[model samples]
Target chain A: MAGVDMDMQILIVDDYKTMLRIIRNLLKQLGFNNVDEATDGAQALQKLRDKPYQLVISDWNMEPMSGLQLLKEVRTDTKLKDLPFVMITAESKSENVVAAKQAGVTNYIVKPFNAATLKNKLQAVLGAF
Target chain B: MTDQAETNGHEQRLEALVSRYKDIDPDDLVNIVEGIINTAQGDLSSVNLKVYGEIEALSRYIHSARQEIASLRPDEITDEHIPAAGEELEAIVGATEQATNSIMESVEAIEKEAETLPPEVAQRLTDSVTQVYEACGFQDITGQRITKVIHCLTHIEEKVNALLETFGEPGERSARERKANETSGAADAELMNGPQSSEDAISQDDIDALLASFD
Candidate 1:
């Protein structure tokens, strides 16, 4: 079943427009053609309701709905619960990590991360095909 | 395709580094890249959380209002209720706008900082930062290269704040506010494309080589 699954559909949510474009392009570069974006958690939720996304790559902090809140929302909703969520942030503090884990973040990546690191984390969370 | 081209380009850059700094350790370059990336990512995360908090507050308010609205009986539908609902919706939207602005501000700060780093490093950092930002949902930063600039500003803010503290900074509070204001305008613009693309995700071999050469 996993083998038959095509490129993963990823939802990249951030409040910055440039960041969204960068993620979309990055995913495309990675051979993942199915990518969508939401500027914040609310919009991201709307998109999630509108479609099926295999993975959600989100920023930890945002307006109206932070990544943690979104993660919690996704987890609490029966339909969206258990969705794979990777929280990307700039904070590397242990507390932040613990908080995210507690909130059910599948993985966390600190900002300014290189492509290599991002790929490794993704592999860890999404698993290698 | 674009990411592929970007990766190749990055490879060429790594090769250039190997040839250009024979006396330097490749790891040094890698370290530098890592430092920049880590710091930038940290800044991005803070921005995300700050905006997220604001949104959550607003969302909660909306939820409360929604509950109240639901509790009202059919006969309770009054002209007064209509205005209140509109006001609540306006507040929610306002909160969203505020959160968006905060995120944008952080992006701008990151971009500004990216501009200060070494060219290749700056570009890579810029790309990665932007990619994360966009994957999160911003539509405006699509083709922009402002992540570097924003990162640069954050660095400046840190330096400035540190310096002030070292000298027993008196205007510490205002200094932070001033720094925040400095990047507000940068956030006003829309986004550009994510980093060069997944095709650009550097391979371990290439990364090792670059690090080795830089070491």
Candidate 2:
């Protein structure tokens, strides 16, 4: 809130409803009140194409489409390519990190993460909010 | 009645038939002796026919048994049962998600209320609430684990359904499974397996180091 635009439009995508709520609540706690939600990559992609979002926080495993796929699509799009995207998922394999990095992820947050860890990941991309 | 093959293979059987019955009406001969007396052969033909019938019946029974075991639910297991198991796991995921949301809702209310309390009490309450938020993460991890299980169940269902097709009539499940197998939408998606336990998987520190390398 002090150093960042607390009103910046952010989109959080995950297939799990609870995870969505958790992320929304966490983002709210961090003073980023303007947030959107998508349940999977296809819906998230559609949302991204339709509007401008400051950041994308997505889970890696989802039906029909995964976060990595969504990131790849975003990176390839001229309009959305530079949008900051962070992947927050239970996937912690080394290759998963490598793949997300290759696809232009802003940061990776493994699952079972606490508020501190989430804040750190966010601050890294969003500039120390 | 027709001249036998008289081939070297069946010659012995043909000789017995010819000598015993000759021109006799086999039916009449059987009636005189007993019902199965080959009726026609008046000798081993009835016994041979009975043995052949028994063997045929046994073969049919064995095939039916194989169908029962392999098909599991016989008619519906392939189409329904395995999917049902996977559905049950999905339901569990749903139930856990519901419970997790309920708990988070309460935590949200608590966090909201913390603002009204005395500063020290509010800060303590907020800290405890943050812990609750962290604890809520179990829902995500467990949900992922359950999803992996559901995937496994679906895989097994596919395999079982394939075996079912071999033993029984091919049906809708088989066709659907074949279609799914043929579709390679994400050829290497399998390599990006979901998270492993902390001990088995890379840590945040490791990821940070990797990200630095990319930078």
Which portions of model 2 miss their true places by more than 4 Å? B1-81, B168-172, B175-184
Q: Which ten residues in a row have the lowest lDDT in candidate 2 chain B?
A: B175-184
Chain A TM-scores, per candidate, are 0.91, 0.97
Please give the lDDT score at residue A42 for candidate 2.
89
| TM-score of model 1 vs. true structure | 0.40
Span of ten consecutive residues with least summed lDDT in model 1 chain B:
B184-193
Model 1: DockQ vs. true structure: 0.05
Tens-digit lDDT track of model 1 for B1-215: 57789889987998798899788777787789878878764455556879988999988987776555446532122224333544555465455545665775676577778879899998887777655554444333221223334444445545544544444433233212323234322321111112333453443344334323432
Error of 2 at B102 (Å): 1.4
Enumerate the chain B TM-scores of all models.
Answer: 0.27, 0.59
Which residue pairs come into collision in candidate 2?
B26-B40, B30-B39, B38-B46
